[model samples]
Target: MSGESAPRATVGSESLERAFGGTAACNACGARVAEYRVVALFLHETAAIRAYCARCYPAAADGDYHAGGDGLRLDYAAFAARFGAPGPPPPPTTPVDRMLAALVADPALRLLAPGSEAVARRRRRVPYPVRVGFALDGATSEARMSVAPDGRMTDLAGDPAACDRVRALLAGI
Candidate 1:
């Protein structure tokens, strides 16, 4: 590696330090270093080395670079070819969809179709039903929701944890 262009140490040195015990953040995304996270170190034509989190590294790979030397070179096309194109974005979520996703986030919970007879039968066998039914409506503030086995429409608007998880997931999208 060129002493001036590349670091005397190998790539990911900071990430390694942070992973072991030190604290470091990705220069690109500002994400804290973590053991499971992948960080890429890029040496630019200006002789500046930058660190990026996995999500931001792909974009960085496309930047301009100098000729290959010191075992460091940025090949945008090759890098993109090595990693296939990203998939299409997820479909947008409506309020009812968010509500349903939150309701079913629990492993034991199930979303059942409305007026399903199996829901009634399952309710009869257990004190508490594990299923929930919902009707999606773009006009409503929240989906019309009902607990299984009882089949009574109720509101989960007061559920903070469920609402939080749903909001977090939506925000990530």
Candidate 2:
């Protein structure tokens, strides 16, 4: 989850834009904003996008990166202590693998940082059922996917919006 474009998105209350914008809730502040200063979308975590307003912009993650004039400093040792190894090992090869990878690679799905390593292990049976079953297991969430006989309907165990996003991702593949 590192690229852009979520198919359906919006900016702020100013206007109703299209193509991967964001929601109304401010990540820093619970109130709905008049205009979204920033939107953050994470894969496999929340279904909706995160909206940040101008009032809370300085308190968001971008602010942490911007380094405000508070004289706060995180040296190398502190950084190392704060963050250990990045994540679990990458998922092994499987029939349903790389779908998420494709989503991550797509420049159109500017998803936030990926939190865990997930594998798409195929649930197999004889004759290759049209209703394919697979699971994507990550460090935090485990998502299950199944296709209908016609290959139209899909069932995802996690967030509905996330399920829709995954369905869209799989559709593109």
Candidate 1 C-alpha lDDT tens digits along 114-134: 112222333364322222322
Give all candidates' CA lDDT scores. 0.30, 0.33
Off by over 4 Å in 1: 1-21, 35-46, 64-173
Off by over 4 Å in 2: 1-23, 44-48, 61-173
So what's the TM-score on candidate 2?
Answer: 0.23
List, residue by residue over 29-124, the lDDT tens digit for candidate 2: 455545555432222321122345567554333311111111112222232233321122223322322343444433333222221112111223
Top-lDDT candidate index: 2
Deviation from native of the Cα of residue 168 in model 1, angstroms: 42
TM-score each candidate: 0.21, 0.23
Name the TM-score of candidate 1: 0.21
